[model samples]
Target: MHTSTEFLLALWTLAVVEGLRVTEVVVPPFLVIGQRARLRCHFALEGEVLYSLKWWKDGSQFYQFIPRNDPKMVVFSVAGVTVNVENSNLHEVELVDVQTSSSGQYRCEVVAEAPTFNTHVLSANMTIIGKGRGALSTSAQFYLLETVNFGTQHHPYRAPWHALP
Candidate 1:
């Protein structure tokens, strides 16, 4: 019951309705342990109040940042996942101290109270590598260099526990 013209019109309508594309967030591919990494959110729409921001995964809410409710920033984790909220910028959030538990597809929800704009959902892909290693043991040779004035230093003193004999 549809003509060629109708089909063309329908296609254009579909494109316009879904045209407001979501923003893309870029983050580092890898982060060192105890170092901080930030995921930046940018949207086509600007000047939004950004009333509240939330991060979620697997249909479960992880963390939230709201200016009115929270006095200081908060980072919370449950079920082996973590979330961090930073509202330093205008309409973006920053997560610091990237950990292995922070690797996943995190969905960011931003809301604007006035003007009633569409809710924006941005996803960030996070990955963590190079962690969980024991500290290196102290070497006797390293200590010998520092104690050059001790007992002529002709022969280095080796700890009995670490000596071959």
Candidate 2:
């Protein structure tokens, strides 16, 4: 009977080990390829110091911001991925020059300093909407610019032009 009570107590203790509460997660569903993007993760800790905050894209580590790191490590970023952390205020980050490859599920993982040593993770998805597809479609529209000083007159609006496949 006493052993059963001890087991239950241990289980409860382990459940409370995760001391961080993620309040909100913000991500845009559609973004232009050339425009900038922003991702925010809001969290509240239970009397614990922040150890590290990291961002992952499609299960791969992309960006990391460590607060309590000694020597104050610079912003961690992956190759080919441009994450602007200069304007980041502890819980948010901006992405510049977004690309079609930037479309993916992004996860924010926050870790608390020792004693509790808790960790929490939240994720959201984003999509990049480009002007055109990888391959041009037969029905795609093509705009013709006005002819300067041409003998014939030009239409003010562009007409729908389809190319042969």
Candidate 3:
């Protein structure tokens, strides 16, 4: 008895009212080798209860948080991802002594509990740069350029050759 438009509108209303959304994903675009990095995932759960929060690096899951679990937190090992589990939780994760190999796409996935089990995901890229040995490596220079183009407000990317030493 309902028109197509009415049905579509009702679906939209339901989703908007009961949806879990990832509002922001904060991953530093660049970092110096051996420096620590903090990644944050912010979400809007609307009226849904949180089921789990997960962090993935280059398609490999490295961290998870489940509110109903015994410990509520779990960690997995992935190449180049050294999670500082002691400082990690639902809202943020910290990585200690990041290395050049840590550069990769990072994703945050959030799921809602119970019958619906709605899920949402968001991702960002990060790059790690080593100090100049003698001259900058080709990949390092490339990363510097890329960071200049797409840099975060908190850590504005800059290349100061003189400051290297």
Candidate 4:
């Protein structure tokens, strides 16, 4: 037994609470091994407070940036990879000295502040390209390059065994 006005109000409420949505995720199609690249994320909510932003590589949570946290940003180590959380800009993160292992789907998860706690996730794949096959081969190439050049010329794109240090 609901009045017409009450039912209309209920419909309006339903239309407004449209959870969370990730607008876009921007990542370079390919990254040069041993070079740095930034992955950008954009999100929006109907009308909710932003709780935090979290980044994941290959479905594993590696970094989280919470505005309310003491440190504001926290990171976890991944094999053959380095993660630097950019606090000033909440849109992107700098992955320094990338490696082959860095090739994977990067996800940006947006969580709403409390109450509803709705979450929206968006992901994009990143590819790492290098002349050498693997880390070992890349290291060998570097050693030879150093010996041949006598430490004269430096290649910025060339990565060592542990490229993502």
The prediction achieving the highest lDDT against the true structure is 3
Estimate, for each residue in 107-128, the C-alpha lDDT of model 4 and write its tens digit: 9999989888888898998878
The lDDT of each candidate is 0.54, 0.72, 0.86, 0.76
Clash pairs, model 1 backbone: none
Q: Could you tell me which residue pairs clash in candidate 4?
A: none
Query: Which candidate wins on TM-score?
Result: 3
Question: What order do you get sorting by TM-score, best first?
Answer: 3, 4, 2, 1
- lDDT by residue for model 3 over 1-165, one digit each (tens)? 999999999999887666888999999998888889999999998988999999999999999999899899999998889988889889999999999789999999999998888999999999987665555545432225334334554444656533332
Q: Point out where model 2 deviates above 4 Å.
A: 1-18, 70-73, 77-80, 133-165
Q: For candidate 2, lDDT tens digit of each residue in 103-164?
A: 88888888888876688888998876655444456554433333454468654554333433
For candidate 2, the 10 contiguous residues with the lowest summed lDDT are 140-149
TM per candidate = 0.51, 0.66, 0.77, 0.67
Query: Per-residue CA lDDT of candidate 1, range 1-165, in tens?
Result: 999999999998885444223477666655544456665656554545556666665456766666666453445555535334434443445555666676667676666656564477867565555432343544211111112246665544532222112
Kindly report which residue stretches of model 1 are placed more than 4 angstroms away from their true locations once superposed. 1-21, 46-51, 57-59, 63-90, 112-117, 132-165
Give the lDDT of residue 22 in candidate 2. 66
Model 3 residue 22 distance off true place after TM-score fit, in angstroms:
0.9
